[model samples]
Target: MDHTAADDISHQANAWFALFHGGAPTPEQRAAWSAWMAADVRHAQAYAELENLWAASALLLQPSPAAAPVAPARLSRRRFVGLGLAASAAAVTAGAGTLWLNGVDSPFADLRTAVGERRIAYLPDGSTVEMAGHTAMNLDFSATRRAVELLHGQAFFRVRPSAAGEFSINTQAGRLHTREGEFCVSCENDAGLVAVSQGRVQVLTAGQQTELEEGLSLSFSARATGDIQRAELAQMLAWRNGRLVFFNEPLLTVVDALQRWRKGRIFIMDKQLAARRVSLILNLDHPDQMLDVLSRALAVRTTRYTDLVTLIYPA
Candidate 1:
C-alpha cells in the first residue's frame, strides 16, 4: 500500500482501538467496530500491532512490588498509539529501525520531571533550566560547548552570558542557538516550538535559518520551517508562574498541555471536539479541576473509567 493509504488505515485502527479501550461499547458501536475490523485484512494487522505495543508498554511501565503505593492510574493509550505511528513513519524506509523507549524514563536523559511536578536546575556554567512537568532532556557540556537535547516535553532556558560559545538546544525538529537570553522550547506532536522572552536567538531547521528577537516565536518540524511571529510572552511563559494560557487554540493542544500537569490520561474521543477552538487560562496549581473546567468550557461530558483514564465527548 502507498503511504497515504497506510496512514488512513492506521488512523482508523487507532480510532476503533480508542473507542473500545475507553470503556464498554454500546451494542451498535461494537457492531460497527466489528464490521470495520472485518472489512479489511490490513485493519486487523494494524490493530494487532496496537495491542502488542500496548502490552509491551504495560509491562515496561508496570510498577514493582517495592514501589510506593499510589492512586491507580494507567499509561495513556493515546500516547502509546502516537509512539507507534511515529515509529512506523520512521520505519517507512527499507532497513530502518525503531526503538519504543519512553523519553522521560530513558537512561540517557540527564534531567526529567514527573507528572504535576516542576523543577529548576542550575548548570555548571551558571545557566538555569526550568523544566515543566513530564519534561526530559540530556545535557552535554564541556569546556568548549554547552548543549542540551530535549528528548520530549518542554523547558525554559536562561543562558548565562558567555564569550566562550553559544548555548544550544537540540530538539527532534531543529536546533536553537542563543547567548545571554531566556527562551522556552517545547516538543509536541512531532514539532518544536521556540518562543523568545529576552534577547535574541537563532533557529535552524530544514536547511533554513531564522532569527527571533524578544517576544517572537517560531515552530518547525523536520521537513518544514514556520514564519517568525510575534508572541504573547506572558501567555507563552505562563507555566513558569503556575498557569496555562490558551488563546483560540485547538482542544487537542490544550489536552496535550493538561496531560503534562496531571497524572493519568485524558482522551478526546471525538475528532470534531478535539479540533474545536478554545480560549482560556487555567491555574496549574489545581490540576484536579482540569476535567471539570474543560467540560464546562467546552460543553462536553467527561467519563472516568479509572482513576487514570478520562474520555471526553459531546455532552
Candidate 2:
C-alpha cells in the first residue's frame, strides 16, 4: 500500500480502538466494526499495529532504573498522531479508575458487568445477586462466614436463609450483615446507600451499628451515616425493570446514574447546571438517547466531542 493509504488505514484503526475502549459499544456499532475489519486484510494489519503501539506506549510510562535516562524517540507525523490518540485513551481510563474498583481491573473481580450490561449471579450457597453495569464484587465463603466485598457500583442482593452464618457485604462506606434479606446497595463517591425491601439489615460504620428493617434505607460514608428514610422500593429498584426514575434529584445525581447504563463519560461544564434539580423517567433500553432527552427537557446544550466524550452546558 502507498504511504497515504497506509496512514488512512492507521487512522481508521485508531478510531475503532477509541470507540471500543471508550465504553461498551452497541450491537450496531459492533456489527459495523466487524464489517470494516473483514472488508480488507489491510484493516486487520493496521489494527494490530495500533495495538502494538499502545502496548509500547504503556511500557514507556513505567519508571525506569537508575542506570541512565533514555533519550526520547523521534516520531513521524502518523506515529505522532497515533501516540496522541493513545494518550487520550489512557487519560480516559485513568479518569475512570475509581469506577473500576479504585484502579483494580475487572479481571480480579469474582463477579462483574461491563458498561450497559446487567448480570444475575447465583452463588454456591443458593443466594442470588443482580449486578448493575460497571459493578464489581468479590466473594469469600467458608464454613464460618459468607462474606462479599462490593468493590464498586451497585447490586441488588437476595440472601438465602442459611444456618452457616450471617451473610455480610463490605464496602468502603461500611458493612451490612443479614441472614436472609432482599436489599439494594450502591457504592459511589466513597459512600454507600443500603435499601432493604425484606427482612432486616444490620449496618456497621465508624464503630457504630444501625439496624434497618424492611422498607427502610440508610446512607453512610466513612465518617458518618445519614438518617434512615422510608425507601421507595419502586423508585430505588427501577433499574431492575430497565428504567430510571429520578424525582427532584440533582442533575449531577442523574448523570451519575446514567453513566452506569451507558458507555463514555458525561460532564456538566457548569456547576449551576449540575446542581439543578430534575424529575424524569428514562428507559435504559435506549441509553444513547438519554442525554438528548435530558438536554431537551432542561434547556441545556449537549456537545459530543467523540463517541467517548460528551459535554453539557447552559443553553
**What TM-score would every model get versus the actual structure?**
0.67, 0.68
- lDDT by residue (1-315, candidate 2, tens digit) is 797787567557756765674457899999999999999999998777656644543343343465463333455667655744654554222223343322224678899888778889998789999998888899999777799999888999999988778999999899999999999999975699999989999999997899999978999988999999877665678788776766568887888888788776666777777788986666677776677667656789876654555667789
Residue 161 accuracy (lDDT) in model 2: 84
What's the true lDDT of residue 184 in model 1? Answer: 90
Q: Model 1, range 185-234, lDDT digits (tens) per residue?
A: 99854588899879999999878999999878998998999888766565
Whole-model lDDT per candidate: 0.74, 0.77
C-alpha lDDT (0 to 100) for residue 209 of candidate 2: 96
Show model 1 residue runs off by greater than 4 Å.
Answer: 1-104
Which 10 consecutive positions of candidate 2 have the poorest summed lDDT?
A: 94-103
